[model samples]
Each structure stands twice: as structure tokens, then as C-alpha cells.
Target: MKNKEFIFLMILAAFLSATESYALDIEFSGSRHTVIKDKPEASTGLNDVFTIYDIKEVSFISIGNIIAPSDFRVLIYSNLGGGYAIEQPVSITGTTAFIHNPKGDMGYIVEDGDNRYCFWVVDYAGKHFDISSIEAYPEQDCDMTKITVIGSGDQIRYYSVSGRQCTLSRNIELSYNTLEWDNENNSYSLVEKTAGFEYLQTPLTLRPPFYCNTTVTVSGDRFLKTWGLGKTLESSIIEANGIDVNTEAVQTNLAPDDASNMIKSDGTMLGGSAPADFTFYAYVTDAVLHNEWQIADDPEFEYVRYRFNERDLTYTFDQEGKFYVRFIGSNADGSCEATGETYEIGIGASDLRIPNVFSPDGDGVNDTWKVGYRSLVEFKCWIFDRNGHQLFYFDRPELGWDGKHHGKTVSPGVYYYVIEAKGADGKKYKKGGDINILRYRKIGNSSGASGE
Candidate 1:
């Protein structure tokens, strides 16, 4: 299979350089002209060469300094032994002439058979005239179903005749065939034919090229069905004159800087519950024409939790750390992703410590033991008594307990407390410790005795 493909490519290259065997001549009445050299005026000017692959809808020719109907009459010669003049109307802008097939005609397709035809622009009165460049465009109803490339490689993708990426699918019967060559007999024979593959029953409009060792398959259907119906598919081999596919437009190239530190509100290393804000920065190159930007933390990008403008290129990290950001930029062809640098946030316990002891004797000194929190984005504390009773609960570290239970003072005892907090780096922390309640003894003396 590989050898055959190599041979096919070589043949294609040779054919591309081969000159057309047929030619069209324009005769003059007074001053006869034999051959029209490729001069800028007569033979040189057309934006592109006329071919069925590049031209789907209509063909436009720009001939400079063309004299109205009286100067030249256009004719086409077909090896079918027939010569005919084009009756189509020619529109002109300045000195450039525009030619089109007559109304209700399917434009023009250069015949591929031995009886091929050549187009000629000549002076109607046998006067000399110059021909410039010619260009072709897809007509409203051009047929391309007869040509196709069957492969399963990445290069196989759907594109409009105008060279824009497209999506389309059509029901097509695919068949695989191979040729067998006999060494002694020096003859070639068909070896096998398999057309029952369900995967090939319906060929996707966007088919990739097949790798080596893959079977050669052909589409049974003539044309591909596009957005609606009757849309045609063109071959992609450059030498074959297919639309010029722009590969870079579908490429993905984007990156985000690595190794970001989780910081406190003061831009210092986040410790405990500091409420700091940090930004993640990424960039998409100007050369990449991507239509979608994807940002996620999961390696597979299961979901995207945040988004930032392409120009801004920033993602604010509010409280979570050890983030694995993935940035993907893509178009219709495929997608590429960049795994950004990981950021780890460590909030030191010293910044958010809880006092082990406090007294609430109503004397205004050490009335409550509040959980110490520095730069905390979120804080929660739960206090439980020795018997497993939840004595107090608060989300703010500043909102501490007053040593009261059900509106009554509880007996002095040791209590257990749990603390949970989120720092500015977007990290969660949990710690628990024991707390002691101390009360001064009240001296009961009837005789004006002051309590010590």
C-alpha cells in the first residue's frame, strides 16, 4: 500500500508539470496571429489558473483593454470535433472584461476526456487584443461529487470551496479493494473486495487521511451532503488543484506562566486564614486563530469553574491552593492544551491560634477567648463540652463564646473546640484544641468583708 501511494504521488507530481496537449487558436482577418505567447496583456493575466477543483460555482476572467463586442468574439473548441462561440454576455469595468456562462447554464467545467476543450478570446474584427489573468469562483450550482479522497489520516478534514473549515456528513457506501501482482506472469489482478464495514456505510464529510498499512477505500456516493443537500466534496492533494487549506488557522498554541505563589492580602506567603487575592496569568499567541478558549483545573478538564477575558488573561484565586490549571485553545480541526504551573498555599497555624484559657467573671478582663485569625477569608469554630454537648458555634473568629450556656453561666471546666478557616490563597485548614475556663472564688463574709 505504501509503495502504491508513493508511486501515485510521483505520478501526480509529473502530471502537474505536464503541459496541456490541446490548444485553442484565434484567427485574424487582416493581420493573422499564429500563437499567443503568455504576455501580460493577452496570456498572462488571471488571478489563478482555471481548474475544476478551485472553481465550483463560476469562472471570472479579467482581460484588460478589451474592445466591446466588435473587437473580439470568445470561442471554445472541444475535441468532440465541435467549435462554438460563447453567447454569454460580457460585463466590463473600466477596461477589464468579466465573462460568465449564459443565464441557466452550469457555468463551465473543462472537460477531462480525450475530447477536451480550450477557451479562446479573439478580436471580432481580427484586430490584435491582449489577454490578462483569469480567476474562478464556486458557482451557485457546481458539481464536485465525482472527485474525492478516501483516507483516515488527520489531514482529512472538511472545508468549503472557499477554504473555510466546515462540518458535514453524508451516507456513503465504502468499499476496500487491493490489486495483486503475479511475479512470474507479470500480470496484475484484483485480490479482494470488502464492502460490508458498518463504519464506512456512512462516511463523514470530514474524513482524515489514513495511515500506512490501511486499506484503500472509495465512496460509493457521488456527492457529499452539506449543511443542506447536494453539496460537493473536493480532493485535497495540492497538485490536484483542491482548495488551499490553511493549516495554521486550526492550530492551537497557548500557554500560562508557571509556579505562582499563594499570597496573603499583603502579598506575603499565606498563613492560616489570610484573605489575599492572587492572579493567574496566561497568554494566547496572535498567530493562533482559535475560536474557543477552555480553562479548567482537572487534567481532563472535566469542567471549567472560572473564565477570564482573552485580553485580560487573568484568573483570580480567592481561597483555594494547589491548583492545576489547564488552558486549551482550539478551532474546528482539533485542540491542544497547556498544563499551567501548580501553585501550593500553606497557611501557618501561628497566624490563626486559639487561646487555651480565658476567664469570663464579668470583671471585663479576659472576658472571652476569641479564635485568633489573620487575613481569614472564612472561619468557623465549634465548641463542645466534656459530655459531647455543642456549647457554642460561630463562623467569625471575632464572635467568640461568653462562657454562657442557655442564658446561664456554666460551671468552670475544660472544653474541646474545632476550628476551620480559609486563607486568601484559596486553601482550607482545620485544627482542634482544648480550652480552660477559670473563675475567681467569691468570699462570702457577713461583716463587711471584701472579696479577694
Candidate 2:
């Protein structure tokens, strides 16, 4: 182990890295290049392995801080795959012995041999666990106290461009519930005070003379101010700091546009088509989030999700049986990864859809008549007096009932219902209901009384 540690030191001295290692445990070969480990299903490479016997360095992926009793993810370049930056994230447990490489490219890991090895320790407190041995990156040397911009067409989406930071109160809480900090379901956000980044929207096209430079500024957080994009694209820019970020999402246009049109369908700006009104659909996608990249874009399990890339749908099953549901689309770069929505399914739902709520009260809330299908091409609902005499018809969900017949409130009694609808499936499903309206009211000259 001592010999292995010596080798790691030598390689780190050679790399002369510029990044700060935060939570990851790193190691290197004799050349100072990184060693890579990866887990594909996740965006942050949480499952990558860092070899200890080999020995090297640990460098923060960038400039940041790592806290003990919390889960940290690291990214390392691979010396094995010909200089490729592979992920070698280390989930620290014990007060593991690791340090930054000379170049800051990695965390010089303990070589496994005589007395050193990089491994974590675990413990079960009252209810949770604790993980420690964390390090923070160095602060940027540049002052950058000021912010400026030089262009338009400024657009920032996803977790990309925010200026909000966590504010700690005078009384700080130091209790570490390892499970709360290390659980995949647990996320900790620290909003720090930062400045010097902005997002500005210049005219879609350079108004007069066209220049290639464009800029966005993001300010207000210290942690983000130092995240240099490597190359400057435009002088006019927007910037922000102290905001939450999924740094692992380095790829471009990889997530679905939550508000854009459904992919390949009507209202879509990219793929799919805009079908004429009334189309039925049912689709399902995973709700699991591999990493923090698209954390804010995940679907609501009890609601629906709409996307802007590819909208392909087929009827799927739900607890309510097979129903028409729709998944607008998936992101061009993301594979329903940390991007989705919640849902329910039903038959003939693509047409004027009516929820299961029916008003049987003489008082109005859902009273009078119901045409629950709001977006229907053609819809009709009929109410009868049990003798089969048609008394009401409705076509819109918003159309309410006053519980009256010929300007007189109908008496509390049993009623019959029939519905006709033209749904997205083109095929019609005629359904009927035998309802009982049990609402009662005061009977007198302006009498005021009611019950259900």
C-alpha cells in the first residue's frame, strides 16, 4: 500500500490538473491520466468503481465541497480507454485516506498493499447511517464581482441557469442522519451567496449587423461562478451562482421540453404531427430518476406528462383497466431517464372525456346535467324521469345543472342517463347509467331547506 501511494503521488504531480476534487475518490497511473469507472443507467455514474491496490489521486470533478454523512458522486477520466474521462465515483464511508493530486485532476487514492486501502465504514445509529471523509474544492481566485452581457436570444432551460442559493440561519443544525443524507431519495441543497452570471435575450436574429457572439449571465451563488465552460462563446452573457446543478449532464439538448408541443404530434415544434382534434392515446414510461440531471422534469405519478420530442402512444393498462393515455414525447438526448409523468388509463378516453364525478343533488355543485367531456368534437348526455321522457341534454363539462324542470326544481327521485360521444378511437362506446337524485329542499313560499 505504501508503494502504491507513492505511485499515485507521482502521477498526480505530472497531470497538473485545474479541477478540484469534492467527494470522489481518485487514483492515477504513472502518466497522470485518470482511471475510469462507470454505471450507465445513472447520469452521475454513481456505481463506478475506483481500484485501491493500483493507487493514485483524488481530484474533485470541479470546484466544490463534500460533506461527511452524505452521498457524493465523482467523475474521473479513464487512462484505460485511451485518455477518456470515465466515471470513478467513490461513495466514502470511513475516514478514508485520500488527497488531491498535484494537478487537482483527482483525489490521490491510497494504494492497496501494506497499510493503505480506500474503503468506507458503515454503522447503524438509532435509525439511520453515517458516511464521512469529505473534502471541498478551493475557491476561485478571480474576483468577478461584476456581471455584464452583450447579446440577445438568451434561453436557459432545465436546471441550467439559476441564481438562487441556500441561506443558512444563525443557528446551524449539525445533527447528521446518515440515511437522510445518503438515501437516494434524500437530496440536500445548499444555496450559497454568489454573483456574476446572467441570461439575456437578444433579438432572435442580430437586428442589424449579425455577430456570432451571444452571452447569458448567472449570478448570486459562489459555487456556480467558478464553473467555467472551458471556452468563452460570447461576451454578452447571462450568469448565476449558488444555484443547484446536475453537473453530470454535460451533453446538449438531451432532455424533453416540458412545455413544447407533443413530439411528432399536433402542437409539436420538432417531431410527430398535429393530428386533427380528438385523438386517443395511451403510453407509459419509467418514473425512476437515474441521477440529478433532470430532477425537476420528472413526471407527477398522479398526473400526466407532456414532452417535446417523440410522441408515440399505444393504449396501456392501469388499475382502472385499459384506457387511452398519452406520453407526449421523450427528450432527443434522454431515454425517458429521469423524465416522465404519472397516469391512469381507460377506454374511449381519447374523445370528449368525462371524469367519474356525477351531481345528483338538487343544489348545484355537480347538479342539474353533466357533459363531462370538455374537449370533445361531438358530445351529448340525456337525463330521463325513469319513464324514459328526455328532460336534459349537455355537451360541455362546464355546463352545470340547476336541478329544475320547466323552471321548477325537480323532486327528489330516481333518474336515468344515456351518453353519446365521438372519441379519438373513431369507434363509439355507448354507455348508460341509472342514477338516483336524492336531494330535498324546503317546500313553501320561498322556503329555504335542502339535503342529500
lDDT of each: 0.37, 0.30
Error of 1 at 11 (Å): 98
Candidate 1 residue 157 Cα shift, in angstroms, is 77
- Give candidate 1 misplaced runs (Cα > 4 Å): 1-317, 320-350, 441-452
TM-score of each: 0.24, 0.23
Please give the clash total of every predicted structure, in order: 32, 79
Model 1, 1-452: lDDT tens digits are: 25564344323322322244433322222222231222111121111121111122324543444334244433232221112212345565654545553211121212222222223222112111111211121221111111133332122122211123322222344333333335455333445443322122113222211111123344422122221222222232211111111111110111111111122223422222333333433333222234323345554557665554342243333444333343343322333222333333333322466789887776767766776555466787888889888877878654677776665556777998888887654557899989899865533212221110
Candidate 1 vs. true structure, TM-score: 0.24
- Per-residue lDDT, model 2, residue 421, is 60
Indicate the TM-score of model 2: 0.23
